[model samples]
Target: MLKGEKLGAAIEAARIKKGISKAEMARHFGVKPPSVQGWVKYGRISKDMLPRVIRYFANEVGADHWGIEPGDPYAPDNLVQLRPKLSAAEGMVVIDRLSVQAGMGAGKLAEHFPDVIDNLRVSKDWLRRNATFTSMKNLGLVTGLGDSMEPTFSDGDALLVDRGVRDVKVDAVYVLSLNDELYIKRVQRRPDGAWLMISDNPSYEPYVIENGDRDHFQVEGRVVFAWNGRKL
Candidate 1:
């Protein structure tokens, strides 16, 4: 069976056992229906989605609810306990998200080497943090969302974003927004007071910001460091 199929079986079994419809399951997990379906049938979901699934199942039927002790051969690791990791095959610049069995192995890596990996990613920018923003100053976590900055800022990379710095240099990488949608891009200001969004990955398209749209976009902060690996 494909990996997604294994994930699908596990999801199907859990939903049936818990009396949750696929739609309810999607809502409970805060994900799209197709994504949930993909998990059960495709055995895969994005890195950000794995934790949610784990929490749902674990809350409903796993260790906290079922009293299944760890290390028991019969103990089942539910989807709610799954952690996500990234994998990038050679020649593929884009990183693929991999769902792992939390507190266990991630696919073949789990079967071969346990406790050695938490997560994985291909971009070095995963370490960029916002050095100076109110909450970020204290939390030091980067708020990464969206896909325009593909190959650099993934849809779900948990950044150790510093919030201490606010100044953005022209043509530098900064997290900003337009129309309430967040974007990560290099800023190139024109003499006419316009900005251009440049993506590092050729796989993505670049955009030019109109003067009228400038007010809609505000610099959240600059990236300093990020973490690209899986969560333990």
Candidate 2:
């Protein structure tokens, strides 16, 4: 039987065997006293929470007498519980890749031609939820670097860039080729044809493109989705 079917039995038997009161057991698991009582009354545990309940029993009691087995594969892995991805709603898609050595904060990124070395597979639904533009042809993966936008986007993060969005839009993050150096910064359009290139972190001062400075800056693309995880 699935672990859910036997959760109450296992917990009840384990508690009775250990001679522990409901209050003490509730305290150990960080649950309300009524919750523990409910578990005994209703054997069924919440499907999503079952895995954690299963783990707690094994680690604390080391009792195999419980019907539920150890290392339950049904439990969602670390990524599922922790990162909470946007999931492949309709299968997956292959996206163009730009490595750290070429893109990111390493140097001036390609303005005209892209050297597509590899591809990244992601849930198409993730793209659908994030993308504003329709064309997948302009989609490319970029490696993020530095802490200019800490707690927002950070170094070693993965960014999904839409090359089609080369126009400066209000409060949008853009990848730019400035003075032969590639940098990712937020842009705000001013009334006088001037613009402000901002960093989320106040430590890095904002840059102003005073109308005349337009020639020095080029919009490479707009960053759409930022995947904050290790680049594997």
Model 1 stretches astray by more than 4 angstroms: 1-139, 143-147, 162-167, 229-232
TM-score of 1: 0.36
Candidate 1 lDDT over residue span 1-232, tens digit each: 1235655676677778768788887775666898777887866776555445544454233433322345533333443233332334443222211232111001111111112122233333332232323442122344355554555656656554333445455456665644544455667887887787777667656678888987767665555444555321
Predicted structure with the largest lDDT when compared to the true one: 2
Question: What lDDT score goes with residue 159 in model 1?
Answer: 53
Alpha carbon lDDT at 15, candidate 1 = 76
- Give the 10-residue window scoring lowest on summed lDDT in candidate 1: 103-112
In the range 1-232, model 2's lDDT, one tens digit per residue, is: 2344365777777677657788986776567898888776566566655545544333223324443333545544431222221222358875756542223334444433333334566776766876665477678788767778666787777787887887786578888887667787878999998989888888878879999989888887888778774221
* Clash pairs for candidate 2: none
Predicted structure 2, TM vs. truth:
0.54
